[model samples]
Target: MLNGGMKWMFLILGTMIGAGYASGRELWQFFGHESVLAIALFTVMFSICCYVIMKISYETQSSHYLPILERLVGKKLTGLYDLLIILYLFTTTIVMFAGGGATMEVLHFPYWIGIGVLAILVVVLFFWDINGMLSMNAIILPLLIILLLAVLLLFIKSNVNAMLFDWMKQSNWPAAFTFTALNILPLVAVLSAVGHQIKHKGEILIASIGSGVILGGLSFLYNQSLIQVAHDLLVYEIPLFAILKSYPYYMVLIMSFLLWTAIYTTAVSGVFGLTARFRDMVNLPLWIIALIIVTVMIPFTTFGFSTLVAFLYPLYGVLNLYILASILIFPVLKRYDLLS
Candidate 1:
């Protein structure tokens, strides 16, 4: 049986790797070669954020998510909190959908077919049993690790340039790294959900954060590899796959599955979160709500994937800062309140 700490670690690893590392897009922009520092910063921040979220969730255990929000921000701010979280989840869902489409295109599948199939499947899986759905991360995370390592091995064997030191000096390094943290905010939301489930709060929080440290360190190394081959990376739709293409088509299959799984997990999680939010208002059942949400959002897939990344991602950064600050300052405020 998995310990609660292990389960929490699995959740964080599954969530982090889904977008931050596996997508290849994040490391491409965030750290590139210079991403080493960004990754280090992220790991430390990630651990701290995990601790804060765990503390908050533990303190408010058995309450639904909204009441906790009301307590943290006060009733006067509840409307603002709902609006902000809704926007955040909505934007995240769009990214995941767009990313899923892009991943399909990268894997040589028809754009609509790939996106549509995954959307429907995710709806089913999420609604089939909401509580049981957490297990999806545990099941898929190991495969993502295996596939990531295989790609790394192939890149190494091909003698791909491993130095991206030149990219460390690029002007966008700071902006990119900043955006990477912004990009990962949805991850914190999901981690909080998992934290809500855990019985051993402190141990799970520490172990989950330890996983982030290990992952962020490894991601820094991988981002550098892309910088080493910057020219080739810029041209390919799926640059990581291009790197591993030197091996065999079979390798592409493995890589494609890994990439798609990453995007798919993020998409599935976001949509489920969104659907779960509206369960009380709708006259229909939970599955029906999930179905309607995914179906309605599916058409947005026709729009450009890169376009959403370019537009919504920066806006997301602004909102993320507030959430990050709130999480960070909550503890200090709590301490001060107690003293008073």
Candidate 2:
């Protein structure tokens, strides 16, 4: 059995590597380019969110975030709260499809084929136990960290100039904040399923936030590398993959699988959450519920990748922000008692 610390680490890693983290689009959208400093700040905020999440998990220990929100916000507001979470999950699922499609397109595979392969993989993974899902992250986190670091470190040694912040200034701050609000919620959503299971809320909070700091720093490193390879970065639909292509042909396989694993993880989690919820509703068979969701999601998953990330993500981001603010602030008020 995985120890508590390992389990927590797995949760954080899986949550962190969600489609947004993998695709580089989440960072691209939020920080524009990827200023080391700005990404650091963004990570700080994300860490704070993680800290709060750990608090929720410590307090509840085996519950989802919505029930806590319902308590904090009341039954009516709770309804709205769950609705926003569902939307966040749905949007996340869409982005996973998009990211998977984009990665496939980069590899010279058909976009729909990528989507179908990932979607099927997600459905299969969702059948695992919740704790099993946690273990999967052990595999995922190391793979992602190693590959991502390899790319960033290679570019750094090559003396690439980081242009993440400069690129951000060219984009509007207001627009960036708008995107941040939306993107951040999905980050929160990924954690919601397991937030309550952590044993040491304080430690988990620190670790998760700390991870965000590292993520921000990495983003800046990536941005700098991208600047050096500006021509190549702009060529591939998936800029990050384009970076990996810089390596030997064999490494491309590693890079592609790394990217796909992240996308697959997100799709599985999102679909599992959706299907599990429906399974509880009206007492439907779990397989039947899963099948229903797969059918419904087939079309949305087919929507091209770049379109979902570029267009739909911002709109979704706003809704996530509103809900996050509500959830975060809900506990601060004098009217509510978490222990109650």
**Candidate whose lDDT is highest:** 1
Q: In each prediction, how many residue pairs overlap at the backbone (N, C-alpha, C within less than 3 A)? A: 1, 5
Q: Model 1, range 1-340, lDDT digits (tens) per residue? A: 1466666666666556654357566567555644555566667666666676666666666223465555456677667867766677676676677677777786668777777877777777855654545678778876787668656755755654564345355544355335544644555455445445667765656664677676765676577667656778666655676566566778777777787788777776676556656765677876777777777777775666655665666666655666566665677888888412
* Top-TM-score structure, candidate number: 1
RMSD in angstroms, all models?
A: 3.2, 3.7
Candidate 2 stretches with Cα past 4 Å from truth are 1-3, 71-74, 163-180, 229-234, 282-288, 327-340
* Overall local distance difference test of candidate 2: 0.63
lDDT, candidate 2, 6-32, per-residue tens = 555556556556666666656565554
lDDT of 2 at 181: 58
